[model samples]
Target: MAFFTGKVALVTGGSSGIGRATAVAFARQGAKVVVASRRVAEGEETIGLVKAAGSEGFFIKTDVTNEADIKTMVEKTITAYDRLDYACNSAGMEQQPTPITEQTEETFDQIVNINFKGIWLSMKHQISQMLQNGGGAIVNISSAAAIRPIPGIHLYNASKEAVLGLTKSVALDYAKSGIRVNAICPGGVKTEMFERFTKDNPQAADAIIQMHPMGRVGESEEIADGVVWLCSDQASFVTGQILAIDGGFILQ
Candidate 1:
């Protein structure tokens, strides 16, 4: 539990779901956490959970799609913690199943901006800070859809796949610099995103659950375990790798 006794962790989209769970997980291990999301109320709530877990943290109202906001997030994290040891870029969006013909440029822009461009800008500034600190670890939240497409959310799938490529490329760039970067492909974890998905396609709820050989969907905390592990010293040798916490969704 003291593995991160004096360390710091940053989690984007930390207002709820996987991001919220990850922040609390880091706190439980003794790391001070920085929770960032555009949602102020939920973000502050995450901070409360972090404090309850025996560590201190603050919430930052941030929109990852903006480069300025991304820069300020890291800056603010350092301002509070002095250095950043781990980071998880979990801020992303899900697009409801829509035919390509019906999808508009607006949808494409919003999805790509949040899922792809956001991570890019995030990593750009984050890596700069990590390099200055002499080393750090980063975990990006991709999706199993990157490997097994759901047939409708093509943009979401593509954005996640791009995360894989970017993860490897960044890992290589900072390989000798004491920094590591990796991606996690989660299946149908019980997150708000999943709820929204199932709510939109009522029939999809069951179909999605059965796709997992585990006979059920995963919890956001389960994925949080993977994120925290990737950022821990136990994974010191793991980098540029894709860790699947999907309950065998991609197996079929």
Candidate 2:
């Protein structure tokens, strides 16, 4: 039997890229998925992918930065699935590269509200539901920038770093409560976000790609695979780990 058979996974930011891939990966492994994202159309498309993977799922229009929206998203999941077994907080935004002096408070808040606080809010509600189940796993999507400093986008970097710290703290807080919280720091992955980050400077993108010891950026599926593993029984003893699924980008 599939390891995830009879399990249910709730994935935020299910609209595209790593989020969509992780949801489908769970489906392929025999789990029912609940996809949530602010993008209704693309999120629906992800539900289609979940079905195509031979599993079932539905989509919720969710804005993670909004507490009420996130609460409703989890509420609806329990309403449908009757139990919450796993959650992947994947919805987030990226800031354009800019020096710290040029970065505004607006940009800083935008980055933290989504990348860091969004994860916190997500865990806040997800843990409440998970406690009822007696146990569950959660994976938050962070970035390699969290630890390794690049140039601009300090806000993004700081938010992700904060996520790691938050993850470890929460893991200990819930250690005896049957909830395992973890985070993933992905290297440069080929996604719409990456494209947008590099659209104006294709050369810069190429340069970034070559920085990886693997000589290329990672794919969405590769990172998805890591997420699935971390949530599986194979990782039952693993929690609060900042797993780097980068293509050896940190090696540099």
Estimated TM-score per prediction?
0.98, 0.98
| Model 1, runs deviating above 4 Å | none
Clashing pairs in 2: none
* Each prediction's number of clashing residue pairs: 0, 0
Query: How displaced is residue 149 in candidate 2, in Å?
Result: 1.3
Off by over 4 Å in 2: none
lDDT of 2 by residue, 153-210 (tens): 8888889899999999999999898788899999999999999989889898998898
Scored by lDDT, the top model is 1
Q: Report the lDDT of model 1 for residue 109.
A: 97
Model 1 clashing residue pairs (backbone): none
